[model samples]
Target: MGHFKLLDVFAGCGGMTRGFLDDGEFVSVGAVEVDRSAAATYAANFDPTGGHTFAGDIADYTNVPRADLVIGGPPCQGFSALGKRDPEDVRNQLWREFVRVVRESDARMFVFENVDRFAKTPEFELLRTAASNGGELADFRTQVFRLNAADFGTPQKRIRTIIIGSRIGPVVEPPVTHAKNPIGDVLRWVSLRDAFLAGPVVLEPGVRDEWFPESTADFQNFQVPGPFKLRDLHVTRRYDLTSEIRYAHIAPGKSRLQLPVELQYPCWRKNPAGASDVLGRLRWDQPAVTIRTEFFKPEKGRFLHPQWENGGEQVNRALTHAEAAVVQGFDERHVWHGTKAEIARQIGNAVPPPLARAVAGVVADRLQAG
Candidate 1:
C-alpha cells in the first residue's frame, strides 16, 4: 500500500517524525520546528528531499502542503508538571496553529501529544473542540489516551497524553507490548541497565573528565564510541563540590533523604521527610523516571547512574548526555548537535520513539482501512 503522508508541527528533533519513518507506515511530506538547534538536529537526520522541512515559526506556515495525516506535540511547558502551570502561557496558544494546519490541509486524521496535564488545561479544551470540527473533519471522533512509555518497552517511565482525531473511524489505543516484571509469557519493563548497555558505542575504559583550568570544575567532553555516528557520550555539566559530596552519600535507589547529617544541607535538614527523589540515583533493575531537560543535574531529579564498581570503588554519577538519549528511546546511531545543554533540552522534549511507534501502529491501521 502507498505510504500515508504526514506533517509534523513543533517537531523538535523529529522524535515523532523518526518513529513514523522507522515504522515504515507513513512518510513525512513536511515538518515545522521553531527552535534553531532543534530544527538543525531535525534537518541533519531527515533530508528535505522528501518534502519541506521548515525551520521557523509554525504561525508563518501559510501554504501548507497537503498530507493524509498531521501530527505534533506543541510546546507543553505551559501545562507541564515540571514547571508552574501558567494558564496564559504563550506556548499553549500554538495548539491553535496545529488546529489551523489540520483544517487547512484537510487531513483525514491528526495526532496531538503533550504532557498529561495538558489534557486538563482550558486551552486543550479549545483545541479539542476545534480539531473535532473543521474542513473534512466535521464531527471528527477523538480518542484520548494517557500512555506511559515504560508500558511499551521504553526504559523510562514518561506519562504523556495523546489525542487522535479521525474522520474515518474511531482510533484505538495500542495494546501493551511490554509489562513490568514479566511472569510466564508476559513481558517485563525495559530496565535502565538494558538501555545504557545496548549501545552502538561503548565508553572507553580509563577515560575520565578533567577539571576546567579557571574554575576548577569538571569539564564535559563527548567520547567517540567505536565507529558509531553517535556523538556526545559521557558529556556533562559540572556539579559543585557540595552537590558531589551529597551525591556520594546516596546509593543507587537512594536519595538526599538518606544523606548523613554532615552531608545534608539546610533545606534538606529542615525537612528530611519531604522532597523524595531529589539528588537521587536510579535503580539498575527498574525503569528510569521521566527524562527532563534538567536531568543532567542530580538536584533536579533521580538521574544518577546505577552504581558500578571501578577498582573496588563505587562510581555514582548522573546520566550522561548520550545515556539520557538512550533512555528516551532514541536510536543509538542518531546524531546530536549544539551545546550539551541544548542537546539535553532536545532529548528531554522528545516523544520516545518506541512509544510513538506503538501509537503510530494503531493510528496507521485506522487510516489504512479507509
Candidate 2:
C-alpha cells in the first residue's frame, strides 16, 4: 500500500491520530483543536517533535496541508442526546466547517464523527445540503453507522455515530470482530490489571489541602479502618455515593444465574435525574460504562470506584486519569500531558483509538484494492 497522509480536526489528544498512525499506512500531518489545554495536550503527544498546531478557531482557518484522508469529530455537545436538545445551538453549526475543509482538500476520503443524536438533528439536513453542494454528490458517497465500542472489542459499552465519505464508490462498514460479552466478562477478560497495578499513590498536594488536611484532628474525622471493604461502609458519609447496587448472581466460572445482588449501596435510587447519579458498582468481570469527561466528577455520572462504600470514610475517588485512558483502549505507555482535569476532558471527548483503527483499516484496504 502507498503511504497515506491524514489531517485530524477537533482532534482531542490525538486519539484518532494515534489509531491511524498505528496502522503503518497513514501518517498524521496536522490537527486542529480549540481548547487551549486540550490543544496543548494533543500537540505534546502527537507533534512532540514540533509540528503545526492550530490553537485558534477552525472556522477562521483556511490553509491546511492536503492529505489522502481528513478525519475529525466535531464537538457534539450541542447535539448530544444528554443535554438540552436545542436545534438552534450555535455549536451544532461547527459541522459545516468540517464539511467545508474536507470538500476543499485534496483528500479522497473523510470521516466525520458525532453523537448518534446528530443523525436526527436539523444540522444533519444541513450536512446533507453541504455535501450536495460541496461536490460529494457528484464525486463522493457517504454513509452513516451507529457503532458501539463493545462491538469492536473495547471493554467499554459506548455507542457513537461514524459518518464516512469517500470519492471512490460506496464506503463499506467494518464488521464486528468481537462478540458482545456482558459487563462482567469484559472486565475479567483483559490484561489491564498488571498494566495498572497500583502505582505510587501520589495525592496531589493541592488536592490534599482542598479535600483533606494535614492536621490530625481534621484528618481524624475522615479516617476509617485500613483496607475496609466497600460493603462495610455506610452510605450517609459519602456525598458522592450512588444508591444503585449490583449483586453478583453468578460467580466467576459459574453460570450467570448463580450471580445475585449480594449487597445494596445506599444512594441507589436517591438521584432520579441520570443513570450514573444513582448508587452503582462495577462488576469485576464486565466492561466499564462509557468513560465521560465527567468521570472525575462523580456527580456528573456513575463513575464510582468499583470498591467505594456508601457511608465509608475512606477516600473512594473517581477513576484516575491513567485508569480512564486504559479503559478507553489507549496503551498504558501512551503519555498524557496535562492536569488530571485537562486529561480527563481529552479522554472524555476523544474517539476511542480502537474504533478509529478499524475505520482506518477499512480505508487502507479500499485504497490498496483501488
Candidate 3:
C-alpha cells in the first residue's frame, strides 16, 4: 500500500501528528492551528520540511490537502465542564467545519479528539447530522471511545473522547495498553529519570526568579512531606486568579486548605498552609495530575515541582519546557521552539505523544489488514 497521508486540524504543537508520523505508515501532509506562536512552534518541530502549516482558524479553511487520514481535536472549551458548558456555544459549530473538510478531502479515515462531555452535548447530535449530510453515513462507519491517557502508558490520568470514522470498514477502538497504577507507581514505572538524566539541561533563565537551582538538594528529591507543620516557601504568580503572592508552601500529605479560613488563599495547592502551588515539588512514585496550559504559572493547577518543601528554599521552580515535554511523553530529543508562553501552551494542549502512538498503531494495523 502507498504511504498514508494525514492532515491535523487544530494541531496544537503537532502532538497528534507526531503520533501518526511515528507509526512509519503515515506522513503528515498538513496542519491547521490558530495560535501564531503555537503554529510557529509546530512548524519548527514537525514541518521542518516547510510544506504545510495552516496558521489560521479551521473554520476559515475552504481547501485542505487530500490525504488518506484526517485527525484533529477541535478546541472544545465551549463544551468543557470547566468552561461555560453551553451547548449552543458558537464553537460547537466548528465540528461542522471538521466534517466539511473530511468530506471535501480524499481522506478515507478520520480521528477526532475532544473532552468527554462532547458526547453528552447537543453538539454531538449536530456532528451526527453533519456527518450524515456529508454522506459519511453512506460510506463511513463511526465509533466513539472514552480513553484515559493512563491506559495508554501516560502517567497522567486524563479522560478524553476519541471519535474514529472509516470509509472502508468499521472503526474499532484501540485496546488499552497500561493498567491502572497508583499515582506513585505511575511515576516510578517509566524510564523518565533516565531520559531526564541523559538530556541536556535546557533551563530558561530570568523568567521566574523563584526557580530552585538545579544543584539544590531539594531539586533531587521528589517526596511529599509527611504530616508536618507548613511554612511559606516563596512568592510567584497564580494563573486562575492572576495574582502574585507567595507561590510555595509546605503541607501535610495531600490535604489542602487546612489553614484557618482567614489565612487561606484561593490557590490550587492542597494543604493551603504547607504545599506550594505551581512550582511545588512533585512527589516521586506518583503519576502527575493532568497537565494544563497553566502549568507555567506557579499557582495554576497541581503543577508543583516534585522537590518543593514548605518553608524550605524554593528549588526547581516550575517545570522546564523540556521537562514538561517529557512528562507529556515526548522524547527529550524532540526539539520545540517558541517563547515560554508559546511552548507552555503547546505542552499543555498536546495529546500525550505516547497515547497518540498507541492509537495510531491500532489504526495502522487495521489499515494494513486490508
Candidate 1: tens digits of C-alpha lDDT, residues 198-220: 54445432225522112111112
lDDT of 3 by residue, 1-370 (tens): 2288888989987888877787788877788888765666566667764558887888787768897888989876755343344655567557767887787787788888887688987666656664564654447667788887767766566678888877677646776666644353333334233334433433332244332222211101222111110011122332332121333342312312433444355453344445533334455445566778767554465665554456654433455555666667776445554445666687888988777887788777767775
Ranking by lDDT: 1, 3, 2
The candidate that wins on lDDT is: 1
Runs in model 2 lying further than 4 Å from the true structure: 80-89, 133-138, 181-277, 308-315
> Taking the tens digit of each residue's C-alpha lDDT, what string does model 2 give over 197-268?
432222121112211112111111232112111111111212322322232221222221222333322343
Comparison by lDDT, 2 against 3, better one: 3
Better model by TM-score: candidate 2 vs candidate 3:
3
Of the pair 1 and 3, which is ahead by lDDT?
1
How far off is residue 262 in model 1, in Å?
A: 1.7
Q: TM-scores for all candidates?
A: 0.86, 0.72, 0.74
Error of 2 at 220 (Å): 46
Please report, as a residue range, the 10-residue window in candidate 3 with the lowest summed lDDT. Answer: 224-233
